[model samples]
Target: MYHRDRSPCSALAVSRSVERPRAAVLLLHGGHEYGTSAPGAWNLPAARMVPFERAVRRATKEHDVLIGRVRYRCRGWNGGRADAAHDAERALHELARVAGDVPTVLVGHSMGARAALRAAGGAHVRGVVGLAPWCPPEDSVRHLDGRHVVLLHGDRDRVTDPKASADFLARARAAGADASFVEMRGSGHAMLRRSAAWHELTTSAVTGLLGLTPLSSPFTGEGRLLSGA
Candidate 1:
């Protein structure tokens, strides 16, 4: 059974069976604006993008993972907004209450990545997976401390320059945050949709960051290239 709820700031949570013990994950979609190319544009009721929901389900099978795809108000981190960090804070609290102390992972894609860094606070989040994070505000960069963060970016990405992620890496490291950046070769913004290498690289990076075993070949395309034996 799937449970869905409309929280403040237009955020929402959809999950399947939350009674069991599992790792909790919060997926923040990149759609701060209502029109144009928002990161979460493909996140409709039906779409063939990266199976975030499926990925969440797979993670749940091993460790009680509850994925919450979040959406916030406005285009930037509105700390003043009642639904900004406070909304995520409430969600994290509720997730911990339900999952106990299984550790939480905040997975954000594109603009969602930007928000995740801002929303990452308190002592509950164990790690963060930022897929092509955009430039964060100056304040968010300075406050990142005591969190294991993993940044994944496609070398050929055109939406949010990979260099931006590189910059984020530098700032994250300077702030004493455990962070690393993995480059997906020959992949575009939608790395997961490209080929096996992208999927393997991403899954491996995230797995290593989260201390989990790498899953085999999650990609289903035919343009993958394998180099070096």
Candidate 2:
């Protein structure tokens, strides 16, 4: 069953199949670079993530995995305040409270992906899947050591630079992370063009990072870029 819980920093819509989940996945959605207003139920960014939530639920139906969709209290990163990252941190704390120290994966898109990557240093986080991430040069990779990080960016994305993500991947690797980058051809920042491929790659990365299953052949190598045509 699904339930919604509101925290000081964000809200979480959680669905769990078992009483005690063995693992968890948290979904974070995109937003602008600067906005402080709270996102309502129908907010396009939050709504856009619903399908990915369903995809994760279906992919992990047989397993004792908890799926959570996080809604940030604010609409943007809001400069160095990083409102969404703080919200994501709080959500991770809540997940820890409900599921113990179980391994967790964070899946985020665009600005949300930036938040996920920032919050990935949390104790429960085992991996991160960033779809069309908005990675800036100053983003840190120091916290990513020993963690699995997968960045999927479309070459056609004009909003978030795919090249920036590649640079971040390189930094993550240098910092001892198991990081890789996937370039989606003919796709854009919203991820609507090759949506199926995005979903497939995300599910594959999540399950694989959690050790529930082996990563698909296409995503096996380090720093490899797969065609998402």
TM-score of each candidate?
A: 0.71, 0.94
The TM-score leader among the candidates is: 2
Please provide the root mean square deviation of candidate 2 (C-alpha atoms, Å): 1.8
> In order, what lDDT does every prediction score?
0.58, 0.85
- Candidate no. 2 TM-score: 0.94
Candidate 1 residue-wise lDDT, 26-138, digit = tens = 77655432332223434431132246546545644665456665545444443344234444566676666555676667777775666667667646776677776666444
lDDT of 1: 0.58
- Ten-residue region with minimum lDDT total, candidate 1: 220-229
Give the root-mean-square deviation of each candidate in angstroms: 6.5, 1.8
Error of 2 at 43 (Å): 1.3
lDDT of 2 by residue, 1-229 (tens): 4344655544566755458789999999999999998876688887777778878888898899988877688899999999989989988988887778999999999999999999999998999999899999998999999888998998899999999998998999899888888889999888898789888888888898888999876657776655543
